[model samples]
Target: MKVAPLPDDEAQRLAALRGYGVLDSEPEADFDELTRFASELCGTPIALVSLVDAGRQWFKSRVGLDAAETPRDVAFCAHAILQRGVFEVEDASADPRFADNPLVAAAPSIRFYAGAPLVNADGFPLGTLCVIDRVPRSLDALQRHGLEVLGRQVIAQLELRRKLADLARARDQALAGVRAKDVFLATMGHELRTPLGGILGLSELLLEGPAGGQDGVADDLRAIQRAGSHLLEVVEDILGLAQLELDQPRLRPRRFDLDELLADVEATVRPLLRGRAVALNVGRSPTPVEADPTRVRQIVYNLVANAIRFTERGSVDVTVAREGDTLAVRVRDTGVGIPREKLALLFRDFSQVHGDHEAELRGTGLGLAISRRYARLMGGDIVAESEPGRGSTFTLTLPLAPAT
Candidate 1:
């Protein structure tokens, strides 16, 4: 039960090991594949990518071995990293340092051991890429160097993993900030809608009464009414989006005809077209699928309305079809196309098309987000494909039946 002595720079070594944040992490294919390669290349039954920490050696990947970890006192890797080159034990049973070792006397019966220390660019040895066998063995120059090269590759993979994790953390933090802002806006919109509702009521009363006969007063009140209505829509979008974010929606699925749903979406969006040349063409798919018909209409309405809002004089085409066991509803529109740089931001709240923060065609900015959320809750998703200066196509795909 003798423990291995710590390096002189034990504090720095431990810091580097911890910096990777890899100590008890799950096995990844990159590391597993490399170890499998080592086992074959070195002609050994067992291969491991071991990370030596303060009290134990953790195997990030193991091939042909059942153990996940071993005490540092019994880790051959603890001695391997002390050398600049490969450490070899042709016959561990004959060496004083390992003969009495339980690993040698017990199962796994380590008679041969060779390990190449995994060192980072900072010259700190974190662990070893080791191979073990039950019989006395040796490796030629090429096999030894192969282990070293594989060890370096393991370090490279670890560094890549650390970087990718850091990027994921940064992205999650940014998303959290956006969510906080949306929550605030939703709360504020709830508060503002009450006052705006009163304004609309008063304006209507003024237009219907003496203000209607007051000539110019009636015209000005109409403008106020329209503005109030627009603001009210924005506030509603905010409230819906906030509710979706704050709760896991429970979908109520029922049997319904797909064409019947599309009919309503077409009729609702026609008036919003306002005599524009955007023809709303919806294909007939008489598929009797069972789903939440209400949410389906909501998704269709949001997409069609969005298309009608963006296109000034072109046609908006809507199609529905049954692709195998799945249903797809695609909305294609000829409008000012979204740029490649802004495509990723399409479903995010508060993002506008063509990089315009104040585009006249912009809605509450929560329309697409809320629509996508509803679609996903029904076990479906919306995908967009567009080219700049051409047109954009948004496709919604869902299972034919309720997804269990």
Candidate 2:
């Protein structure tokens, strides 16, 4: 419905109403409860805390009303909002302006109407708190005052909801920004690793062959190659994470035996378990899953690596199993568990849980982040559970393709 241009004061009020940012949001229980009580107190079949926008009147709360919004031109509350005080019509049938209105002509034919204008935080009249009835009735002075007080309450609720929404949006934006930075770091790491790997590979070949003469020189060269290779691995992990953040990374999916993959991940991380008095257990059912083999390896590697890194005196357990069309893998460690506050940041790039740079524990803080990215790339998810001073477990869940 086309509403006539609002007058100067009405326009200002309508702008103020929209500024609250409460229109078209989900129904809130706090305002709904207030309106429900008001409806009961006034003994009206229909009651609403309606907010007037440019072309419509929306109910923040409603009782005994099917419609959530109605055209402003045909709204009884629209006319009611023009005054600062109470607006009442004894009977719509007696008023020419509303005589032919659909609410008056149809079922639940509105006859009695009483509305109190709602004002914004700045005291600008914006909309109404109204009660409607089929039978013409008059409200006592106390009821009128109560409705006005309830209208003020509704306004307060709207303002609070608006503030909450604003805060939530800000939080989301901040997270997005952090995710972007992670992507950048990951990309640079990848680019640096590719070249570093080549340099390390060449250095190793030289140290092993006739190019190295003295034993001491050979040891020095081998150390350089090993250190470079480790750094290169770190760089690659960071780059992979960055690409994953932009959602631009592609995985090379292939059919693979789940049991074999689990065995390989176990073998790779076994060296970390030596002399720690910790046992490593691996369990995998003979399940085949279609996924990127390389990416899956990275996923398993990260989880197991993290388990070993955090657990100093206890065993790390790995499990892989399939249920129906889904594959599940879990890595459990008995070590110093992550704190509740730090658990959420585990998958965030460069978000290190350990604050002190102790010699025994060293990490780049990209393991979990990269693991999560690879899992998601292969249509899977990773979740964690941890309790401080006890242990932590990371679970990876993935979908399996059906047999041909």
Tell me which residue pairs clash in candidate 1.
none
Q: Which RMSD values do the candidates have, in order?
A: 10.6, 11.5
Task: Give candidate 1 misplaced runs (Cα > 4 Å).
Answer: 203-404
lDDT by residue for model 2 (204-284), tens: 678668867677887677667656755765776656665666566767787777787788988877755643777889888
Q: Which candidate's TM-score is highest? A: 1
For model 2, the stretches where C-alpha displacement exceeds 4 angstroms are 1-5, 9-26, 91-102, 105-107, 207-404
